[model samples]
Target: MEYPDSEAQLPLPTLESKPEAQITKLPTRPRTVFKNQLVDSTKSSGSAGLANKKCRARSLWYALYLPQLSNLDPSQQEKYLNQLAGLMQSVSSTVSFHPQALICEIRSSLKYFAGIDVIHQKLQLLLEEQLQQWGLLDGFLYAASPTVTGSLLLAKSGHNTLVYQKDNLRSALGGLCTDVLDLDKEQRRRLHNMGVRYLRDIWRLPSNGLCKRFGSNFVNQLNKALGKAPEPTCNYIAPPIFITSYELPYELENLDRLLPIADEILAQLCDFLRRRDLSTSHLHFSLLHEKRDHTEIHIGLRQASRSQQHLMLLLETHFNRLTIPAPVIAVRVEVKNFDAFFGHSNSLLETNSLDATHYKDSKLIQFIEELQARLGEDHVKYVSCAAQHCPEHANMQLDYRGSSKPRLKKSSAGSISRNPRPLWLLQDPVRLNINKGRLFHRRVISIISGPERIETHWWSGADVRRDYYVAKELKGSRLWIYREKGGERGWYLHGIFA
Candidate 1:
């Protein structure tokens, strides 16, 4: 059909005007499989449909560059990097960091935030507040692209471009200056001598020529920027530990003066655990003094906890017992041993409730912890029965942090024995004088039950062979006496029955 001149001048219907259903109903095309696809794609002019499909399959990386970060000290740099990484988690789950830059994968977060634009707006607002708080008046630079290196290159080049599709990446990055490549002086001179001033000029050259001239490393970097090669990423993971330090305005020798500073650090640790739903059972405090000396204090809990009030109480107890050798110039707190926090059932029940067994256990743990803090941790001990026949090896002593219930192992002699044993054993057996074939201690002793022989550890160099008997003293007191079988062959008092 032929149209009039005026009608012919009218604009044609555009793809943007197509209905959603119509677009969905269109036939799908098979994906193209190219040999040396990474290289071939860079050389070919592909269709937009293929590009959109490729882009949808790849992750979108957003790079943030803070120029002021380089001027900050290493500690300050790490602090700001952590702060920015935490903020970026609101927009994306996958975040990676460089010296002064942060790269996050936004493709997965796009659906949650509705679109890339909304994500950008939310992040921009958050970043503005953070920058203001940090006193970074110079602000920052950012860019989004299909590849990590591409986004970083664009961000560092100050382009602030956002290219979502892999197909458009080449042209979008073509105009950037060669300096963004971070070339060495020699490399830059060579590029200049070769009249390669822009990235596009380098792209126009043959891959083999560039590899031979600039080395394969530079060529690989270019490929990574254009989405031709994959780049490895080190995603950020929040550490399980919390470490914070405070510098006092002046050295203070009084222990009471340090409580406030310690309280502040404890509060921060509690907040850190609360946000992560974690609890810690171990804490370390360092009191830095003059002359590069430090006093270290360690706190151990019977149960994992994150209560700031309880921590302060423990800290106060430690402070009461501590003797400051020198004035403290700073205080540093560290907590390692983190555990997943679960709401305690006992916490929801009354202390008197029959089901509040855990509450009673917690009370016991708290008491033990208090004692540990008051006395040194080494002074507090837990005694448990061991699995040995010898009295010396039958029981063991452990630190206060050991299990409340002893794990008993059955011995070859069985769980129960016919022989009656004394409740108390002496450190060293006392020799008894034999008077007319009778044993005598402070007073005369008579055998109540016959001898029970015990012989063990024959394989060891130090062997023990003895015959023990339950005896009674002249005053009606119970006595445990033993007679050596091989060596000494004399009667001795070993223990007393309670």
Candidate 2:
């Protein structure tokens, strides 16, 4: 120490040697990655660099504040928030819902949408469309900021401004009244008495004095608004199954009156599914009766879909067959079986090809669905080949509600038969009188084809053994006749072929 120069001999300042009353300066806002751009607070920049930095960070966030939403009751607010959340999910996957506002991180959506301006415009259009649809176009405020807290505060203060840089955040927050700060009544009174009417006045004070005079919470919130601290948020996740109900204004018995309500519900349900890129194969519609009883209708679709018009048409078909037992007070729609939507490309050539195929399939399915809806599901049936060789057991009838795929395999006995089978089969074979060793029905039948033998189900107790023949009636009508091989040797009529 004695050999050191006067400047070097001076004691180095230490944290403990500083006076307790000394005001420690607030830490500078740390460099952050915002909207794919790095912003460093410590770096001094010219006007152009600062302007460029501000532009780069502006796309980081979007805050949506619905002041009217805060006035709604908890349930209504929750429902509105859910609808808003669904709409916001179409804009960005990362959406956080506050009690009074919604914050979306749109940095990841820039590439897909082209740029921040385009995204902003698209979001504004979508939000406006939804608001107009819901009849809530007023008191909706929107802003952009690099930090969630900054954006939220700006939205809360009803400032539809975009804070694009850290420097911009200070000026933006500074313009707001001190009431925007999360301070107690006493603390606010003290601040007001001290002439700190604006956030800028508080910002000008030493951090240590402010903390000592007020509390740490005010300072912490201020830091969060300025992007100097982390702002934790809980993201909103959509429900897997979409179910909603509406109470009718009056008890209704007519199907025509219910159609409009059903249409609206289907529209909302389709919107929910489309936003999540989902389609439902099954939907349940329940009608709450005034007598506290409910009638539930289950709708099954041949193809999963998220189209509101298509769903409403299906519902109308079902409703046509429905007979109300009581006046309905409410209606609920529940969607349980949802699958990811497989959307087709909209190219002209591909759409033409797909449309042709889709039209055919849809037409067939629609016909079957209409038939089942009108006549009962059990009444509409499809015939499928059974795994049996006996003429009576060669095929079975299946419910038409199922997909048209082969359900039974052909038996080895049936598959090996070289003789052609009849298109129609009798429920039970009618005995043909054998007159002088020739088969006799209304007219004597002549054998056009010799016997093709079929024997099956020997392992089971019920066994069959027969020689089948394609016989021609005298009038040129073909008949499928078979004779029992072991018992009675009686000839029987089994089928006919035209």
Candidate achieving the largest TM-score:
1
What is the TM-score (0 to 1) of candidate 1? 0.53
**Colliding pairs, model 1:** none
Using Cα atoms with residue i matched to residue i, what is each candidate's TM-score against the true structure?
0.53, 0.48
- Among these predictions, the greatest lDDT belongs to 1
How high is the CA lDDT of each candidate model?
0.77, 0.74
Question: Cα lDDT of model 2 overall?
Answer: 0.74
lDDT of 2 by residue, 1-498 (tens): 021112232343242332111111112222343445644322222342456544554435789888767667888877887778777877676778787788898765666676567777777777778777777754478787778888888887878886656667898889888876666889888988999888888788999998898778878888988888888777776667666667766778898888877887787778777867899889999999976678999988766778787778878888888888999987877787788896654565445876667667876776676676667778987787655566677677877665656555546445634568888887889899978977799898999986898888778877788899999999867999998898798899999996
Distance from true location, Cα of 104 in model 1, Å: 10
Clashing pairs in 2: none
Find the 10 residues in a row with the least total lDDT in model 2.
Answer: 18-27
